[model samples]
Target: MPAQEDSSTRVLEDLDAAAVDYATRIAGASGPARAALRDELTRICLPFAGRMARRYRGRGENLEDLEQVARLGLVKAIDRYDPERGSFTAYAVITISGEIKRHFRDRTWGVHVPRRVQDLSLEVGHASMVLTTELSRTPTPAEIAARLNVSLPAVLEALESAAGYSPSSLNAPAGGDGAAEFGDLLGGTDSDLEMVDDKLTVAGLLLRLPARERRMLAMRFYGNRTQAEIATELGISQMHVSRLLSRSLAWLREAMLNDTLPRWEGANGPTDPHGMQIAVQSGGGVVTVQVRGEVDRDTAERLRTVVRHAVSSLAGRGLVIDLAAVPLVDAAGVAVLLDAASAAAVAEAELTLTGAQPYVARILGVSGLQSLMR
Candidate 1:
């Protein structure tokens, strides 16, 4: 029995001599004669290739397919073999083993994985198997890492990525009774979860507002009352209630975004001590309106009125608003500029604004007026 096993496993000396002779002959001849020589050499080496392929039989691949891969590797070795380099047996063994391992590494993954991670996963898996046999139990990641001289995190990552090798389908049954699928375990996006930060921030901001503004906001929103009803309850005009609500809401939005509170104007008007002034000059088919001082809610209407007169009085020419002296402009001021641009458009006149301060220019840019700037 021992002699028979040895005879079955042993490679013949004539096979090596034939391979070297065939490789030399095939390199110089490319016709049907060269192909016949290569085919004959391959038939002689079939038993040797089958032995290499059998080493990987139980590794989740069919034996016949592995043998085919090994045979293909043998053909490549024959084509590439140089007679003076080394023995054909050693070269063919390396090539055939490499081809089989390459097939397993590249083709069997159910999910895409990095080559490094896949290699590490195989190392970790082998280590776990060896340690399990020695320890007589399933080895932990730490044990595998210690045995392989790798970091614990690396072992853990390898084990986690190994799941990608054979990922279970989302539609697959999750339990013994098959009542639920794996997809049933996933949770959906919660709509209110995204608003948690906003709600917390608004709650903190509402506590910082004045008593009257806070009370009015609660009455209008939480209590669901009209502005006129709020005005009557607070003993103020409905217009005043509307202005206060707009101002408070604007301040809250600014505070939430910028982390700075906007200055709240007095009941009479904006707190800007320097009142706005508008001076218009006409020359050379151009009307230039020179503006001075800060433009806010209270002063925006005056600027709007002056710009309107300039637009209506144009005689087939252009209008230029010089803002060199203007220091600051609010949202209301920007609205007036947009209104002027629209009226000029309707009159078939071109309007250009020039010489705004850096801060005021940024405000205009944020207000979508950058195209009109000169």
Candidate 2:
């Protein structure tokens, strides 16, 4: 027994002496030779590192990963170890253990956790285990806090943070039959969210219309009344109600798109000259208004007058506006067209706009008067 103990002591002394020589030589050596010597020493120390690694096994980390961490710590110890400070074995043991613990503290958590809370979590876990063994049951937060000499809140916080260490997968089955997942319990998209902007814009535009038009719109839409019902309530003909509702809604649509309200024509609104000319003809009870120039804010009133007169004497016949020579139409022109269409509806006559240029056609389409296009 004495010889065997002496033999073990000699082996330990030889290892310590060899470690000192390697450290001394590495400090003085440079280039590939120094690297070769460091590698040789690392190879010798690997068994010791692996032993240190095994102590931390079964603690929720792979044994191989912990061994790699320990070996990394071993290399750091060799690079930093000094002969005068202490024994190589003792220094290496501390470094390797610290590296393994740091791997758990920093890398094992599935989510970001404060370092203080992480350390407290370990303590709380240990205290729970001790109390569970002693009391033959899981310990409460207060009991665990008392065992760890901490506040109950801290213990509870640590317990909560423990879940972040290895979070359950969102795709994991939440039902016993595996038909549903955890993510299925989450809320879906709000379909009405897409219409929020449109609804708001329409609301503001509705306020800009006259009270009579607004009431007609509310009765026809909000109150779910037919054109005849709204006309009866307002003591107007169904055709008149149709005209007002059409005009109001079309104006709102144009306002929403342009982000500006177009001027509504009164019986005597001022007119300007944009080199515009209008010619009206009647034959077989079908009146036609031919326009020749750009129809804009400056000339919208002139066109409105000719179309209104044609509709007034229609006597249940159709009125056609020839836009073949018209070059362009603006928001004001679109408003006039909507008003013309409304007037024709009230007169029980169909109003059609024909031969509009591509640009003018697009303007009418966007103004919600595509139904008026021939």
Per-residue error (Å), model 1, residue 200: 11
How many angstroms is residue 142 displaced in model 2 relative to the true structure, after the best TM-score fit? 4.6
The number of clashing residue pairs in each candidate reads 0, 0
Query: What is candidate 2's local distance difference test score?
Result: 0.81
Candidate 2 C-alpha lDDT tens digits along 62-160: 999999999999999988888999898888888988887788898999988998898888777767777889999988899988888899898889999
* Per-residue lDDT over 1-374 for candidate 1, one digit per residue giving the tens place of the 0 to 100 score: 99987765465556678877887778788699988998899999998999999977665678999999999999999889898988888899999988987887788788888888888887777677679899999998888888989899988888888889887899999899999999998888899999999999998887766556789899999999999999878766686678678877987898789866665432222333336668999999999999976566657889999999999999888999999987667777888999999999999999898998897899899898999999
- List per-candidate RMSD values in Å: 17.8, 15.2
Error of 2 at 141 (Å): 3.9
RMSD of 2: 15.2
Provide TM-scores for the models: 0.48, 0.44
Stretches of candidate 2 above 4 Å error?
A: 1-18, 27-33, 126-149, 188-374
Q: Judged by TM-score, which candidate is best?
A: 1
